[model samples]
Target: MIVADKKPIEEIIDEIKRHTKILILGCNECVTVCESGGKKEVEILASALRMYFTNNQQEMLIDEHTLERQCDHEYLEEIRDRIDQYDAVLSLACGVGVQFMAEKYHATPVYPGVNTCFLGATEQRGLWTERCQACGKCILASTGGICPVSRCAKRILNGPCGGSTNGKCELSKDLDCAWQLIIDRLKALGRLDDYETVYPIKDWSTDRAGGPRKVIREDVQV
Candidate 1:
């Protein structure tokens, strides 16, 4: 899932201080699971903003709403009637959701309420770690399910860099070497022989170098 964290309250306040009427929009998807921009978080932020305005002797109209998803056109259409009433909108979704919402509601300015992190997984409660970079090219088959692209500090493709020591990355002792994990998993699967095969230089054109991407599945398209 996409992981994100809330922006500083002071920064958020500064963005909307000029706007008397604002909408605090939350997403019920990724940000919800990450505890950054969910319904609960939106309510808290709305209350805080209201309190801040009240204490400062300022008049502000703050309202909260959570969409099933901000990225989907169908979900975003739910607010089509009410969106224009606000001076501005603060979206508590990933960067994608914010941009998509802004595009959908072109008349209203959309602000990001959280900082989008990366494609990651939840390790434990309150702990999320990067898992994939979405490079467009997948190589997990030869690596025994361990992603060297995202897990490796240096993003090495073939083998462990010399910086690793005792199965730990030199960047940090607590961080496991991506190559080490790959080798161990491969050994357990009796696919150690796969390691001997040299992987050619990756063609990065399929990645971000190619710019924004989209998947078009003709089979699923209506």
Candidate 2:
């Protein structure tokens, strides 16, 4: 899932302070699981902002709403009727969701309430770690399910860099060497022989070098 972290309240206040009527929109998807931009987070942020404004002798209209998803067109339509009533919208979704909401309501200003982190997994409660970089090409099939592209400090493809020591990355002792993990995994699977076969240089064109990407699946098109 996409992981995100909350922005500082002072920064948020600075952004929407000029607007009298503000809408704090939440998302019920990835941000919800990450506890950054969910319904609960939205309510908490709204309350904090309300209190801040009240104490400052400012009268602000800050309303809260949570959408099933801000990235989907169907879900975003739910707010179309009431969108115009607000001076601005503070979207507590991923960066994608914030952009989609802004595009859907071009006239209304959309501000991001959270900082989009990366494609990651929840290691445990309150702990999320990066897993994939979405390079547009998956190499997990040959790499024993360990992703060096995302895990390696230098993004090495072939083997562990000399910087690794005792199964830990040179960058940090807590960080496991991506290549070491791959070799261990392959050994366990009895696929150590596959390691001898060197992988070819990855095609750079398939990644972000091409710029904003889109997929056109004819079968799934309406």
Candidate 3:
């Protein structure tokens, strides 16, 4: 899922200060799973903003809403008529959702309330970790399902870098050595011999660095 974190309250306040009436829009999708931008979070932020404005003696109208997904045009269309009631929109979804809202509602200014972090998964409650860099070339089959491209501190294609110590990453003791995890997983699967095969340097050309990627499906095209 796309992971993100709320921006500093001060920064968010500064962005929408010019608008007296604002909409705090949240997403019920990815951001909800990551605990960054969801219905509950939206209310918390809205209440905090109201308190801040009240303490500052600033008169502002703040309203909150959560969509099933802000990135989907169909979901955003539902708010088309209602959006005009507000002077600005503070979107609590990921960066993609913010942009989608902006494109759909060209008249209203849409500001991001969170910093898009990464495409990741929950390592544990309160602990979200990146597992895929979306490098465009998937190699999980060769690495015992461990993604060194993202999990590794250095993103080494073939490694257990000398910096790794006792199965812990050199960059941080709190981080598990990705290569070590791969080795252990491979061992459990009786595929330790797979490690003997070296993976070539990644061909980033297939990834975003090359150009915008595209997918065309003749059957899906109407």
- For each candidate, what TM-score against the reference? 0.98, 0.99, 0.95
So what's the TM-score on candidate 3?
Answer: 0.95
Clashing pairs in 1: none
Return whichever of 1 and 3 wins on TM-score.
Answer: 1
List model 3 lDDT by residue over 64-180, tens digit each. Answer: 999999989899988888999999999999999999999988999999999999999897999888888888889999999999989997889899999889999988888899999
The residue-by-residue lDDT of candidate 1 on 1-222, one tens digit each, is 999998999999998899999999999999999999999999999999999999999999999999999999999999999998999999999999999999988889999999999999999989999999999999999899999999998998988989989999999999999999999999999999999898899988889999988888999999
Candidate 2, run of 10 with poorest lDDT: 203-212
Off by over 4 Å in 1: none
Candidate 1: 10-residue stretch with minimal lDDT: 205-214
Q: Which residue runs of candidate 2 sit more than 4 Å off their true CA positions? A: none
lDDT of 3 at 74: 90
Clashes of each: 0, 0, 0
For model 3, the local distance difference test gives 0.93
